[model samples]
Target: MTKDGVDTSGSGQQSGKPALHSVYSVNNILHKVQILDGVKVTYSSWVKLFILYAKGYKVSYHIDGTKPPAGTDPAYAKLCEIDAHVLQWIYGSISDDLLIRILETDSTTYEAWCRLENQFLNNKEARAVALEHEFTYLSLSKYESLDDYCQKLKDITTQLNDIGSTVNDQRLVLQLVRRLPVDYDTVGAYM
Candidate 1:
């Protein structure tokens, strides 16, 4: 996982400090990492983990999606689209777990999930949940400092953890945040 001279931490930090929070973000990269049982992963279990994070944090959903009922109900459609993309990402990373979770969901929801899955199978970039414009707005250009980014990340992470989200790999997100070029200080991966 360590790239050439990538520092792993990607920056410097006080040694021997235990992590207070598991998830991290900078410019809303959405690494969706989770750390459990000492195993760290990024881009893995992203779908369910994202869903868990959203529900756990009470994050609002957007309506007006691309389908029937959802297409008609903008708010519900937006939520469905968001959920579907997240589910598709998670399914790609961990198909078995996603399938199991889908099987456990209501048949209607599962069917919706399949449609989302097909969309992803057809095109990867087409399902990108995080948009470039949105990312640019959140990044350092407007935010102005790493502190701002970390603070926002902390708020989001707090919400996700407090609500018992499904994230299974926290270290990945942490590492990605620390690697962010927003500042000179490098953050180490969780020990």
Candidate 2:
């Protein structure tokens, strides 16, 4: 046993030759990744984190459009196996209803991932409309502070940008001025 407690007697030899150290392990990667729960608002961030984690393990190609090579090459085969394993983990992570919505035709991990993005994250038109509606209807409650209201508006604008629409800074400033309570008319004019 080495100082780290890994048994070294069987560690080096594989097929009568010394083996190179394997860098990626599913257990290690999975331990750090959070399962997707099928919420559209959080899906983008979740996928980004998962991509970073998988890239650290050199397995990001499984979802990034690179096809696993065909044939009996040991490294290629191992990568393909890992890809399938990672894909299975992804499938297992999402809600059952969402999993069922994944098309039967999506034979690879990349295709399934794209399907989910299209279903949830790619509705730019709908998302923009919804955000516009929310912005139009937003009003500060009597109990809500000006800072809190401004933060809420900022968050909505950020969400709009994330979904491929951008609110101009001038428009946002105007909205803030227009939406203030009547009592703040003097303060609004000073700005």
Please give the CA lDDT of all the candidate structures: 0.40, 0.70
Local accuracy of candidate 1 as per-residue lDDT tens digits, 75-170: 565555445544343344444543554443533334644543443333434322222223323444445676766554444333333333422346
lDDT of 1 at 187: 49
**TM-score leader:** 2
lDDT per residue, candidate 2, 12-74, as tens digits?
A: 554445454333345444466566653332566667787886677566787889866767766
Taking all chains together, the TM-score of candidate 2 against the true structure is 0.62
Tell me the TM-score of each prediction against the true structure: 0.22, 0.62
- Model 1 global lDDT (CA atoms, 0 to 1): 0.40
CA error at residue 40 for candidate 1, angstroms: 9.9
C-alpha root-mean-square deviation, each candidate: 22.4, 6.1
Top lDDT hit: 2
